[model samples]
Target: QQQVKQSPQSLIVQKGGISIINCAYENTAFDYFPWYQQFPGKGPALLIAIRPDVSEKKEGRFTISFNKSAKQFSLHIMDSQPGDSATYFCASTASNTGKLIFGQGTTLQVKP
Candidate 1:
């Protein structure tokens, strides 16, 4: 139930286009959800996050839409650039244990 499943193992986008990724989880205990972006040979870094209390959150060109009842969430990258190419992972954390469960990554590539 704690597992987060992400789709589209790979994605290709034209520069300045939009990139979208989806994720779902079954764990009701999960209260904190975060998205991380990782570059090759580096660790993942927090991109944006949304809690169950919020339906959506946006930061700059990045946005996260969450549905508590559906146990689903999605990330949208606007004006995607070649530099945005990287592996993105969606993760969930339960309040009690703070244990984080991550979804399989989606590799996004933006063409010039």
Candidate 2:
């Protein structure tokens, strides 16, 4: 089973600041990396993603970066707002099995 380790169980960011969360994977076989965000009482939603072929991917205020050699990745939230406060999760998956291994999770609070 593949495992993912995430840092900073919780984070506090000011509005219009940047929020960063990191994850490291144990298996080299994992090919896809994605970050999910979930609000209170809501299901996790795909925020951004990166594959082995790309070093980084950005969508609006969200960015995800991949380091293939290090088997690690990170999610950055730019111009973070109070609405951005939520629980973030980093996950790894292989193309074949399609099994997602998720990190412990990080709760972010974007203060105004």
TM-score of each: 0.97, 0.96
lDDT over C-alpha atoms for residue 42 of model 1: 99
lDDT of 1 by residue, 6-111 (tens): 9889999999999999999998989999999999999999999999999999999999999999999999999999999999999998888847899999999999
RMSD in angstroms, all models? 0.7, 1.0
Q: What C-alpha lDDT do the candidate models reach, one value each? A: 0.95, 0.92
Which candidate gets the maximum TM-score versus the true structure?
1
Stretches of candidate 1 exceeding 4 Å from the true structure: none
Off by over 4 Å in 2: none
**Model 2 Cα lDDT, one tens digit per residue, 54-103:** 99899999999889898889999999999999999999998888579999
Pick out the ten consecutive residues of candidate 2 with the lowest summed lDDT.
92-101
Q: Give the TM-score of candidate 2.
A: 0.96
Evaluated against the true structure, the overall lDDT of model 2 is 0.92
